[model samples]
Target: MDHLQCKVFFGLVICLWTAKISQAYQTVENDLTDENSLASSYFFYQRPEYPRDCQEVQDHCSYTNTSGLYLIKPDGYPEPFEVYCENRQDSAGWTVIQRREEGIVYFDRNWTEYKLGFGFLATEFWLGNDKISCLTNQKKYELRIDITNSYGMSFYAIYNMFRISDEVSKYNLASLGEYSGNADTHITWCKINTGYENCTCQKSCENPHECLDTCDDEDICICPEDYYLMERLCVPRKQCGCHMFEGILIPEGGVHADSDCSRLAICRNGQLRWDETYECGNNEVCEIRNNIRQCYCKPGSIGDGADCITATDCSDLYDAGFTESGVYNIKPTSWLEEAFEVYCNMSDGGGWTVFQRRIDGSVDFYQNWTTYEIGFGSADHEMWLGNKKLYHLTKQKRYTLRVDLVNREGSPYYAKFNHFRIGNKDSKYQLLQLGDYSGTADTQSTPNGYALTYHLNQAFSLWDEDNDAGSSNCAEGNHSAWWYKNCDNSDLNSDYHAAWGSDASIEWYYLPGSNYNILYTEMSLRPF
Candidate 1:
């Protein structure tokens, strides 16, 4: 061949070789991205695609028997989806994307795929369609196409995806249908520093500072073995660092002074005191109770101690603010009913929802057919006579029984309980499912096959808020009294006042008392 003719031939060969290497890398990348997206559908922001490959047709992860594609993602998502070829038939062959009954499936002539991106980490190009074509006979053709990559992906080496994406995005949708290829989707080639890439990737690494892992302070040491980086250096495991209880947990990044080494503490993702600990304002102790440490009421300083453990607890529960009718109708439901359905009214003279004791000293919650007392874990509820938790009840031999709360632990502090039927230990089945909750005394086993030894009240601990180191302004709180060298009543009382122990504080407020026969308005632990 002449000099020019030989050069032309070499160029074509290099082009073909380059295409194969790009295709392979893309195949693997698409697989991983697809996998991550399948794993996270709800929390992530998935991009749009005209996916025609098996990757797009269905949600395999969600189905009983289907899973497809896995793609490795970068720290984040890609700015744009790189489109490789102008639309073209895979040299030759076919592919199809379809929905059969409940699922979407794909039949392809070539092996094509899509990838997904995560919100965190490096940005990856996410969401794409793999239009593949198999050539039983060697051939290639042009096709039209559109594609986007919202999931950002990273390769151990540089520009792996930047170059690979070019070969991956191309297909003639007009001609391709699922599983219509004559040849299986297999493209082959190799090497990252080849000619086709034209070294577009070289510019990327020119600035070392541009690398994702690059940090301003190389002097800062890497976190030691088990320890991880916080602001910088390695650190030991932190203890549970909760600052509030009876509310949702406030996360603690690491262990700090003033926290007790209570409960099993594990440092997750460098968070030493995460999902645990209760912190007190100024001077307070994070007390551990029932395997959980919550903010206790400081000596004399009291909070209902109902929700001192969770962030959810700190929030106020306004009346549905009105009636089921929609406005201005605040009411409470009766607790421990014996034979009547009494309700507390917010409009009543006495704000308290008082219960009317029956002639038999019984509150008929179910019309006297049964008598019950209730119990509670927290003080955030529509308290019957100022009490939500009922400890005792008087029920005649065999009568209809029903506790009147819709959900167990109707409030944050209450224990969760639905009526249980008595059962025999050996039987391993509910002997009676509380038909009207009127089952016979179970001599065989406990109600839930659990030893029927402790009552609901006795099963849990009593680290009331009155014994903590100190208190904060939040009302009805439990904490310690450190200001007082000793746990003295006088000092405790004084501290309570300092923390706003009187009514009007958000933590505790006692409404004026009036005598009335309403059954549902008081705030305590009982369900309304």
Candidate 2:
């Protein structure tokens, strides 16, 4: 083939090879980019067509998923051009103006070449000074530069405000606002020369001056003065700390308390160690539980110890500001009384104090009278909210009790009573009143209707304390604690069972047919 023909053929081959490389690199980059870096670029290659501009591309990232090379037509541009939509940055909405990787394209060129731009779009290339000016002039723009050295150490510099001048003034870097990055303060200038001649080895945190007498003929690069060598890069001397938490560099030998002040952390010789010395704030106390020191709000107060406030019942909290369903410390009594946590169901209407909950059967509810009276298990998980607490809470206000249950088939049913009250422990915490039941759980045609009504006016019973008027120990037969007459129409406190018609299963009878398996059950009460 002739020389001219051979050149054209080789060019075609090179273009094909580069396209494959670009595709591979893009695939790998997408995998490595995390959800946090998604803000760096918005438009993906999957976008139906070219966007109007880079700003248009950024607006799409919220609902769109992918990020790669895309075509864009700026406001004043005559024709559309290809540009990279980058989403692998700290923030979003960026049009990559320039990129240099492995120096595949030589940068040294005449003024004409720089103005018009050159090099491959996917690999290493400049988007031309003319195009950059057009893009920046159309809208406000910021500049971010990512750099990686020979040792694979990476750093970034960001200028809050940046703009390029038109070609009239030779395309000068017109406006450059505040500069911010994790780099040394003295990085204002870059000196390019042979290693030893630049006093590279003499630079150190203690002595940052140019070497005058101890100059050696070895090629070595050392950190600048008032700077330390970290990860083979020169960093500010002030940054010589241990990065043990959330990528924050702690000062050398410095101690800091965690967010909750539960424990203290000390940085020593680039290492971090935690101490059990808790520094709790006011209205807080430090205690050792599960082999770790923790801070807890003091009696009659509610909080995670760092900021404690006076505690009140769930109703008062709902009226105040707390509107989320979770475990909250509440005091039903006066200021002098201690506060305890209760799972408050703050949804639906709000301020429903949960007395009992069974989710996954993780907590064993088969207990004696004292255990049932004082309560057991975590407030965050499955637990009985204690009969004593129930009596105190109910006595404070006229409450209506509501029982919410979910069966094995994921169907929900609720039982509500207009008037519900419990007697003190002296009466075995008897269900003194359960007036006018209304709910789907009692919609059966049986003569003994209203499932929960069977336990009304009956004293609470446990295997060890049989207050039930049944022929047998009802709590022992069902392996649960509940108010029982002869037995119960709804044994919600029974062991979790998957099979139907099992006597030991947590059941709500008659309404859903006899002895049906229930997956979840909760009993809560609130004042009208």
Candidate 3:
């Protein structure tokens, strides 16, 4: 063959071979794409076994019905760890950060140990500082502490918002919102030793910024040279006693009366405890004000806490220096049965006895005649002092009635009467008398501003009682107990409505709008 023909023939053969190889490569790529799609589908259908928290597990894992020890993989955490899930308390889905039931685990640990965490989840455990920081930083968390004391009494403290800082900040508590609970006091327990055996630990109490040196190379905890070990806890010689009452550090052994002299607190063996030093009189109560437990005369009572005497009314209590607004026991007459509970509004001049009040929809005002005559609801919350109680209170002295109300928009208004009184059950507990009216609750129908006066001379009616002159039962129509003249010009004891313009809402008409709902209502009477 010629040289040119040979070169052309080899070129054609090489082109064909290249095309065949390209087609084979395309087929293999298509097979790999199909295999990849199948693998992706397989993973997509797989269950999410690793939950971020107990709440996620409760929501996603149907089999996880009961609360117990469970593994949770918190965000930013290295691996999953066991935590006690409390599904029974309050609602479900609570990750218990710390539990001290059997006291099998010693909480005394160094910084590194605390950061990494210790103890078994089944027994006592603190879910490590690092893990907690990671979990809390991921989202908002509420802390609920359930404590059962030595007396077998149970108490719970709930902090609405909680969070902590990262390791760089030593995992300090970054945020803690408002606290609410039944417990009277809040206490923070700081361990003296951060190791297995009780050992002295050097901590800079003077320099608050400096951290404590928990352990040494020999694995034994060491304290400052100046501090001595007391009851296996290290404390400075000057501050050997229990640290309490806003940094008031007592010596190793000390005894002092509490701020209010109500209790005697003793410091012994690096621990502080309290004993009741004084007991209140019959008409006195112990209350914690600004963390200081003190005894004071109750409502409608006077004298020192140890020797309180029953006062005639809220006015008497007001004169005796009982000024805080709250529920107080008032005795209208010398008779033992005449003493009853009433809310005393000690603000805005003081001594105003609240006979009827509705703040939240916690109490039901709709009732039978018997219920209205006696009373309903609690003295501290929403309550009606009762028609019988009201008659006795007003009969004791000439009272000025003040009706305070707040509309849905939170605008306050009031109606005041110079003279107010009610008749006994013989008159169906009628609102027998009302004097000159004045105030912002204007009827607009009348020349003067008093709107509730329309309800005067009318007998109080409940859902079961038909005393109104109107064709239909006013109390029944309004679904509340009230002094209804014809139907009602104003109804304070009506059903609490969230929105405005409801027929059954607690309302005062002709003030600004018709049938406007009142968010709060308080009918108080004060003796002039």
RMSD of each: 26.0, 19.3, 27.3
Flag regions of model 2 displaced more than 4 Å: 1-309, 334-337, 444-449, 498-500, 513-515
Weakest lDDT window of 10 consecutive positions for candidate 3: 6-15
Q: lDDT of model 1 at residue 8?
A: 17
Tell me how many residue pairs clash in candidate 1.
111
Please give, for residues 70-132, the per-residue lDDT of candidate 2 as tens digits. 567665667667676554434434567676665568868888888878887667777777777
Error of 2 at 49 (Å): 59
On the 0 to 100 scale, the lDDT of residue 57 in model 3 is: 57
Pairs with backbone N, CA or C atoms under 3 Å apart (clashes), candidate 2: 39-92, 40-86, 40-87, 41-86, 41-87, 44-66, 208-225
Candidate order (TM-score): 3, 2, 1
Model 1: ten consecutive residues of lowest lDDT: 6-15
Question: RMSD of candidate 1 to the true fold?
Answer: 26.0
Steric clashes per prediction: 111, 7, 1
Q: Write the per-residue lDDT of candidate 3 for residues 1-528, one digit (tens) a residue.
A: 111111111100000111110000011123444555433111111244466666765655544546566666778988766666666534667777776665567767899988888886655777788988887887777776665533244556667667889999989888767777774442123233222223335454343234454434333444435554555565565566666765655555665556656675677876787877565666777775444355676656777555877866778788878788987778877235836888889877999988888989988888899988888888878988888888888888899889888888887888888789999899999988888888877756665634577788888887788888788988887887788878877888888883435667887876654445788888888886
| Candidate 2, run of 10 with poorest lDDT | 6-15
